[model samples]
Target: MAQTATTGTTVAEVMAELAALEDPRIREVNVRHGDDHGVNLTKLRAVAKRLKTQHELARELWATGDTAARLLALLVCRPKAFERDELDTMLRDARTPKVHDWLVGYVVKKSPHAEALRVAWFADPDPVVASAGWALTTDRVARSPEGLDLPGLLDVIEAQMKDAPDRLQWAMNHCLAQIGIEHAEHRARALEIGERLEVLKDYPTPPGCTSPFAPAWITEMVSRQHTP
Candidate 1:
């Protein structure tokens, strides 16, 4: 394990550890999802465990422009320490799916600016950014859907999901599945929209994995909720 300062560890040391941990097979698998890293997430989290919480170190690691490092940064960084605009800039720079997803899931989702960033990113013209927005919206759909317009979300998904880009379409499909699973009032309509759009219906899910297809995903999850 690398020695660390009280405030943080050196980026060089962390980068060295990451380099040693890289595996070609992992990188090959990650490339399918548009990520370029080879460091397994379980190993990466182990590194973060050694480094502990280090906001400044996280920033430095993120600045190194390495995918594995950025993933590590998301793990060790203090989420609430970031300013909203800083988080927005980070999102723009996170072009890879793993980094972007981790940033949103591990950082932005915990920030005070989550809702504000969600609104801004949702309307951005960039599909990748918009996907982040929808990702946040999906979280809200599952956890904090008090004021969200369920019908309106269904309307946009119905209107654009079929033609949306891959990432955006996936995000939209996830939100649709979430709405169907979480809100009984809209479950039938959610199923209807999913059936009509057929987004991700043929996605190649691994054995024992739930399909990303909205109708199947929603049905499976909702069934589990009702299981004894």
Candidate 2:
């Protein structure tokens, strides 16, 4: 007989197959969960709805003692539990570096609302989060007509500033490079940020990522800025 899935099983049960609680478990479940490139997003939505309503499942993502389980659970929770309140909850209580990376990247690459994502991004307790969150504002300029706050983000990551991470400086500069493309006045801002990155091409190394980078856009800006 073929192994049959339970009809009455909860969506969580249908999706999550927990191995014994251990570091190795992430590898096991990750393969199983992410195996199909097209994940069953429908079922994931159901599970997220359940977790959003049930504190216990949500708590497991943050409060549970099982580390691997907790990370897996949070990973699932991201696609499913993206409501503003749910994200706020995770931002407030979830401290795992892995989870923060997932959340921040999601907000940067996927969110429909750039401003809303900015709010969620700032919720991270880590300095990396704060830096990335601030940098994200510039990242959105490429996708939005309202444009990015390049000077602000660039200022925050300034090398001469009181305290700044070299990685963040790189990242913010990268984002500025992307913003340079628009036929808008901010092209100057973009070149300024790109020149910053070019300066760092010889630096020892950096910590966090800089902002976004759009090579085509940066090239355009360089050409336009340099044209006599």
Pairs in steric clash, model 1: none
Highest TM-score model number? 1
| Residue lDDT tens for model 2, 10-80 | 43453343332223444455456333122233444444454444424434444543334444455444344
Worst 10 residues of 1 by lDDT: 1-10
Model 1 quality (TM-score): 0.96
Cα lDDT computed for each candidate against the true fold? 0.93, 0.48
Clashes per model (N, Cα, C within 3 A):
0, 7
